[model samples]
Each structure stands twice: as structure tokens, then as C-alpha cells.
Target: MKRIYLLLTTFSLLLLQACNSFFDQMPDDQLTLDLVFQSKQYSEEFLAHAYSYVRDEADRKGGVPFDPLSDDFDVPYSESPAYPLNIGNWNAASGNYNFWQDYYRGIRQATYFILHIDENRELQGMAGGPQLIKQYKAEARFLRAFFYFNLLRQYGPVILIGDEIIESDLDGNDPKMNLPRTPYDACVDYIVSELDLAATDLPLHFTAQSERDYGRATKIACMAVKSRLLLYAASPQFNGNTEYVDVVNPDGTPLFNTQYNATKWERAAKAAKDLIDLDILGLYKVAGDDGNIDPYRSYRDIFLTPWNNEVLFARKSSDLGWPYEKHTAPRPIGGWPSYSITQQLVDAYETASGKRIDEPGTDYVENGFSQADGTYTEAGTYMMYVNREPRFYVTVLYNGSYYPSRVNGDQRMEFFRTGSSGRDGARDYPHTGYIVGKNISPNSDVRNSQFISRPYVLYRYAEVLLSYVEALNESSPGHPDIATYLNAIRERAGLPGVPQSLGQSEMRERIRHERRIELAIENLRWSDTRRWKIADQTDGGEFWGMNTGAGTSLHDPAYYQRTVFERRVFRKEYYLFPIPQSEMDRNSNLVQNPGW
Candidate 1:
């Protein structure tokens, strides 16, 4: 399988490199079908390449502004004037197009392998042949499903190109190629069926010599992916859009598919439950003897440490590879200023006692600390308002908290007030009154920087648990399991469990708050907002910065005092990105999504 994969990969690369004018030219080194799948190892190698394609498209490193543009995160431009206010537009087209191409390329490769793999299986002599073939086919299906999920999220109701599509009379220059969109239901059905098939042959977990394949696709991963996709599909944006109803069948029958179905949500919950029943990968708890061990502390560490029992699937980073640390770390140390935690996000944390600081009579101050001596003053500090959510202090950096100083000889949390002069020779001094991160390391040694090779976490067990809870609550409101699941997350965060007496709406609010605080700045915020239909509430605004001085511009806001930018709203149309104009031109059958 490995040999087949390498040969196909080499062919793909050579084919991709040759210009359109050279399409007729065949590579002399190309392997014929007879030579390609002679062994199972060759087929396995091809599957590995399919997995690699998924990883390459998703992992946005090298300070490359790809991932953020996918609505997972945002790059606040506090400097560039050309694209100053609309930073979201950066990499919007370029990145989406690249992802589209990469995913389709992977799908095409998997289809090719599936088409030919069975023909060469006659060489297999005995015992393990059928099982191995089933497993390989399952892996290919999973890969295909994974690619389709990406397409569905980015471009709704995409043309479902399968091996059959390739063999159809509509292959080249056929007007049917310009056929209208496939029904979204059709797309979901295709995805769900693929996942179902993949799950049949995939192992629950690997052991012994197969331990090296721990991160590969598994039965649980397929189910988890299906659950997540279904949840999104049933959510407000896609499922709630009435205009998308009346989708046509091949026989031209109208399908009223726009209404949100409670059954779909129930199906999602059931899917998640199926994985939990498998009992292989469970939520990771903190280890050690500390009586007050907080499970939330393990959240950041999981990304830093891959193959963590909690990580279901992650994009593996090789030594000396790409990641986000270099861009977000303090410049003098390393890292560009990419994504920063907003004050709104900062205020969402709860007190250790489980009361939100903004609650009535809570004695919380916008700029005052609960403690005296003012060392960790809340005044003008966003971090101060929310004093002690375990997840809060664990994730955010504020005044007086020690950050590993790259510029100074010793680690220090420099508190720079407005008009404060630098005692030491620190450049970019006192820019922002508060440094807004605590998760990233600030080591000065370039070789040891955390930016490179930090594994990109695609899915974690914590998220899976939370998803199960959320779907269950949405489908069956006020279930006791709601509080149980909600409190499990809270307990990990060193807070008391949620009260069972709270109303369903109140409980929902609390769980959402927990999710916001727990998952902040982990690249999940934007999608969460979209799915919840709260993009306007979360993103529309005059996003503020600290007012440092008179010389400061919109690009460089004063980090010392409060400054606001007008109209930083995220419109509803932003929920789904517009399909690239180039793609639309090629496939006339594709319709531009509404408001694109």
C-alpha cells in the first residue's frame, strides 16, 4: 500500500506541476495499474497520502494567515492601513480556494484507490487479506467523508463528485456539468453513509505493533465527526434558513428541507452517545497528587502534547514545522500579533464560587480589584473584572502575572501605565496596558520557540463530551444529565457544579458561558458564534483597544487607555464564505449562496 501511495503521490505532483498546455504529456516514471497495486503495502501508502492531504490543508502555520480566515480565528490588524478595518478579508478567497482544491484532490485520490484496489487483491493468499482489504476501504471512506465535511461547511450543497461522477457522460464539456446544486440533504446523507461504512471495519483502538497508527482514523473518530457535522447541519444557520427549502430531486420533486428538525438533533445526540458507549477514548482528567488538581489546566497542555489520551485526532507536526506561537508571542521574544482575546471574552469568566462578576450586587468593578494593595488592580485591566474562574486565570494574562520575559533578563509581568517611561530598554514598551495571553511560552531562544511544531488539535475528548451535553440538552431540555455534564466541565475548572434548580434557559446560558471561557482563543469562537446564530452579538462592534497616547492611529491603538474602532460588526452573510469566483466560472451548475 505504501508503494502504491508513493507512486500515485509522485504522479499527482508531476501532473499538478505541468501546466494545462502540457496536459497531454505523460511522465515516463509513471507507474501503470499493473505495477501500482501489486501489494497491500502499496495501497496502505496511498491511504497515508490521503490522510496527509487532510493534514496539510488544515494546518495553517508559518505565520501564514490561512487558518484565521476560515472563521476559526481573526487577525486584528493594529498596523496595516491598506486593509486596516477589514482584516477578515485577508486570505478569505485564497485560503478557501486552496482548501477546496486540496480536499477535492484528496477525495479524487481516494476514489482512484478504491476503484483499483479490489482488482489487485487476487495476489493476497490467505488469513488477513479480506480483513485488511475491508480496513483499507474503510479508511478511504473515512478520508472521503472528512473531505466532504470540509466542503459542506465552506460551500453548502456542493456537487458530490464520486467515482460515479467521474465515469458519467457529464465528465467534460457536458452542460450537465453546470447542473444546479445538490440538495443539502443529499450531501448530509452521503456523508453519513460514508461514515457508517467507515465505522464498520475501523478498529475501536489499535494495540501492539499497530500502536504507531494510534492517531489514524478509527470507529470512534468517524462517529464523532458525524455527530459534529450533524449538529452543525441541524443548527440555526443551515437548518433554520427557510429560503433553502424546495430543493429539487433528480426526478424534479420539491423537497421541503429548510425547517430545523428536532429529530436531527436527537440523531446527533445518539451518534455522540454511540461513541461514548464504545468506551475507548474518554475525557482526559489531570493526573498527580495535588488535591486541588484542576482538569481545565490540561486544556492548553493537550495542544502542546499530542497523542494525549484525550486527543481523538490531531494534525501531526514534524520537528521544525509551522504553528501559531511565533505570530502571537510578544514580538521582542518572537511571534507576530495575530489573534488576541477580547475584553468581552475576558468578562465571561465566573468567580470561583460560580457567580458571574457582572451579576447584580456582585461587588465587581469595571476597573477595581476585589483585593487590596492594587498589585493585581482591576482598574483599566480587562482581566481584573473576572477574578477567579479556574479556566480564566489559566488561559488569560493580565497585570502582575509573571510571563516568561524574552526581552528582560528575568521573567517579569511589566505593568505599564499611561505615560509611563521604560525603566529598562524595552522596545514596543507600554503599547498595550495589559498583555492578553498566558498560554504561549515567551522563551527568547529562537530554536526553542513554541511557535514551531505545536500539534494542531482537530478534536479533543473534552469537546466531544461538551458536544454530547449540548446536543442532549437541546434535544431533551432539563435532563439531569445536563447538570451532570455541565458540572463535570465546571468541576474540572475548580468551580462548584451547576444548580439543578436552575431553569432550562438559565442552564443553557451557563453552559454556553462555560464553553466560551473554556474554549476561548482556541480557534473555536467564530464557528460557535455562527452555529448559535449570535455572530452579530459577538462580532458586531467598535472593537476597543487601550488608549496609550495622542500619536496612536487606528492601526496602532493606544493599549494604555480605552479606544474604539467603529463598525467592527460580523454580518450574518459572514457565516458562510462566498464560493470563489473562479470556481463559479468553471462550474456553471453552481449557484452563489444567498447574500454572497
Candidate 2:
């Protein structure tokens, strides 16, 4: 635990002002270096520009490709870049979601801010005095380290341009400008150390600051990144990955550590436990008048309720909620309805009693309609949807599901052939019968062009708990703390805990399953599958969905049956993204990912 501070408000204000200020600069009358950094406002605006590079996780269409790239969700249009990406129809030269240049530019901007902000005499005389300078510099460091973490996640080992800034007058042919990628473990170590340094100056929480400062970098956020990054480093994809041994620089310098490191898992477990031991965060819960946990409301409102206890980091100000809801809402209610959830994700939800539907004695009835209302859904709901966990109803928009987004009132959504949201020529519709129901605000009325804005949650306490248990299970199986944390998530979701009798391998599968259900559609599965080296098993080949091609009604046998909607291709090289070929042409020291 470290002392926390608040400085994110300046960032949001800077974002709004950059468009009219820095972005509006012209060559003839552009603000010079001294002119920009001399004034406190301009200096703050420049610092905020570094925050602008944060990923638009809300943009499922392109900004965040992980959601659609995974098996959990589908995008209908072939014209969308993700469509070609899913089918393995593109390459490094195709220029698909190439953020390599964009993120590095962000890193440079942060570095520039850190190097120049002290020139502002006005900032030195501000309310907090010179201590504000240290906080601002730490903030810039967080953003720089954060950008490097993303680059490493997507491109494996990226060129780590440390404190030395590449001078603008430097030639493109200079070896300084065309550096080789750092080794994988070194990259991980550098990122974690940077985050630790940033945390010392950041606040543990933003409660004492203005509400606008809520999303700023905190000690908690730094710890969250450290936890996740170490978990990835410990996983099979990077740890002892023999396939990437040849992924070396031009000088025969290995960019990836080929030897297995068992201690990486121990380091990961310690990082997660460090966060949990703080005891400041808990699973978001809602209790009814009966004083029992209302799992349905608890689960649904985690996204709907802004700034809840479960949230660690979120985007406080964004225009993406409207478009995200518009894409996910029913087509009849002015939505594209193309952001559909796969049947595999639909099947991932457990029964109310915490049993998998395929397991014996789980009592999953595939053919019949519900006889009565269960905990999550209504009477006469399809048997496939009835008796499922509260998270299922909150996450899936099925054929007869009710959507409150209609102008008139709540509408029972239909996805049958004759239904309003169903197939009509080549128009956009869910290839799967279900739409993504997670993170969609219930108050949104897309038909009337109305929506309730909500924060895009980037990290939550549940994930921290799960990460701790996962890493702990890997490092030391049957630890008493494993069941303690794992059951907290399950209990919040209105389910039972795992039996302590289970062995290491059994607990491993259970943890993975819980992650799929708890963190579903949050853009985590793509990396999870890749890091675990299970993407080929889970991401490739025939993807199934309810027959959206046929079906006159909800109960029609032709409509409800599982059908193959798309065939995807996943190769070993797909585990890590290819370094853009343009980058290869410019930097002879760089090596492309294997099989690219």
C-alpha cells in the first residue's frame, strides 16, 4: 500500500481544449515549445494529450478488436476490418488496427511532457505548490508505462525507448531511432518497476478529489496492470515458448526468453495478493428487503451503476456508450444488431444451482419451454434460457427476450425470420440469434435516440480476486486462500463455491470457466486464450449459433437448433500480432513474429 494523490481532472479538461488549442496549431502561428510549456494551462493541456492515447475499449467495432476476435462475439458485416481478421484474410501489410506507431507517439508525448513541464513557473505557484510538479511527472510516467504495456501485449517484445528521447533532427537511418526489441522478461520487469514508481506518487483512491478525477491513474490501477502483465508473462505463450526462439533481432540477440521460468508464477501471485491485502475493494452487491443478495440486480448494475465498489479503473468521459448500445440494441429499435454473442458464450453460463448444463443431474431441458419463472427469467421463457445464472440473463439478448429500449415501452425482442430484428436481405442482423447484453444500459431507448451514459469499466475488483486465485493455483495448488477468493466471485454471482476436495488440474479448469463467465465480453478472452495457448482449440474452425438463417418463430425447431455461422482460421503465428511490414522496412534491427 502506498500514499495516493489526485491529478486526473486536468486531463479531461485538456482533452476538451486540445481540439481548439494544440490540434488547431498552424505552421505560421503555431505555439512554440516555450510558449506551450510556460503557461500552466498549456502545459496541463500537453500533459493531457498523453492521456488521449488510452484505448477506446468501448469501440467494439475497431478500437478494441479483442471482443470480436474471440469466440464469444460475432460481427456481421464483411466490410469491417475485424471480419477479414477473423477469417485470417489479412497480413502485416494489410494495415489492420496498426497502433504500433500511434502508441509510440503517445510514449514520446508523455516523455516530452515529463521533460518540459518544469519550465512552467505558473504551475510552481499553483495551489499545491511544487509538489504538484512531482505528481504530474508521475502521471506522465504512468501513461508512458501504460502505453508500453499495451505495445508489449499486442506486438510481443517492442523496442523499449527509455528516458533518452529521439531528437527531431535525427536521421531515420540512425541506429538510435531504429533500435531492436527488448527481451520479453526484461520488458515485463521494466513495466512493473515503472508502475511501482508511479504508484508511490499516486493516490490509493480518488475519494478526496473532485468526481472528474475518478478515472485518473492511481496506485490501484498501477497494481492492476502489474498483476495482469505478470500473469501473461507466466502463461505458456511467453514462458518457455519454444516456437518463438527464432524471434530474434538482426544481431542474433534473443528478444524472447526461451527457457521456462517457474518463479514467474510466484511473482504473479504475489502481485495479485498485494492488491487483495489492501482490503479496500469488494464484489459489488445489492440486497433486497429480505436482506439477501439480489444477484440479478447486483450483476446487471455492476456496469449500469457508475463508480461502484467493484470498479478499479474506468473511462469517465466518453461518447462511445451511445454507439456501443446502438450497435447492440435490436434492429427494430434503431440498432445495427450486428454485435451478437456466440452460442458458445451462451452455453458457458452455468445453471442457477452452479452446475454446467452438460453435466449430469444439472437438469438442462433443451427441447421444452419453461413451465414457470426461475430466478433470472420469466415463465414460458425457452428452456435453454430458463434456470440459468443471473449473469446469463444480464448478458444474453435471446429470441423472446424483453428489451426496454423501444420508444413506446419495453418490447419483447424477436429474432425469428418473420421477426422485426431477424434477417431481411443482406441488411445488418445478428448472425447469431443473440445480441451482446452486457454493459448495455437498460434505460437506453434507441428507437427514440435516447441513452444513459455509463463509464467504460477497464478494471474491477472481481478480476483482481480471480487473478490472484489463478496465479496462486498455478504456483501453489490447494492453498486455502484460493477457495476463499474464488468463492467470493461465485457468491456475488449467486452460486456455490468449489469443493476443496478438487485437485490442481480440476481447480485450474474451474478457475478458467469462472473467468469466462465472470469476465465475459469484457475484451479479456482474446488474450486469455492466447496466453494459455488454447486459442487454436477455442478460436478456430466452425463457430456455431442458433439458426438465424431460418426460423419463423421462437420455438421453431429450425430456428433454435445450433448451426454453423462462420468458419475462422487460427495459426500459431496468430498468437502474437505481426509487426507492421512498414516498420520492418524502416527498422532493419526489428524481427517479425514467427510464421507471419
Give RMSD to native, each candidate.
6.5, 4.6
Please estimate how well model 1 matches the true structure, expressed as its whole-model Cα lDDT: 0.57
* TM-scores for the candidates: 0.80, 0.94
- Candidate 1, 1-596: lDDT as tens digits: 33333334465553212122211133333455556566565556555666656543222332222233322233444442212323454333444333566677778778876777776554366578877777778888888899898777766677687664243334556765665566777788889999898888898643311544655678777877898788777777666667555444445533336666888778777877777776777555675467665455565455555566676665544222223444334443443433344445555667666777778766454553344433223333343534466566556544344444464333333333322221133333333333445345443343355333344556666676677777778888877877887787677666788787787678777777777776665556656777787876766665543443332221222233555523454555666666667667677556665556
What lDDT would each prediction earn against the true structure?
0.57, 0.82
TM-score of 1: 0.80
Question: What is candidate 2's lDDT per residue for 280-371, written digit by digit as tens?
Answer: 88889999789999988898889888988888877665544566888877765677777889999999889888999899898677777887
Error of 2 at 270 (Å): 1.1
Local error of candidate 1 at 456, Å? 2.4
Candidate 1 residues lying further than 4 Å off, grouped into runs, are 1-29, 56-73, 77-98, 121-123, 165-172, 206-209, 243-256, 287-290, 318-321, 368-386, 404-410, 413-454, 548-560
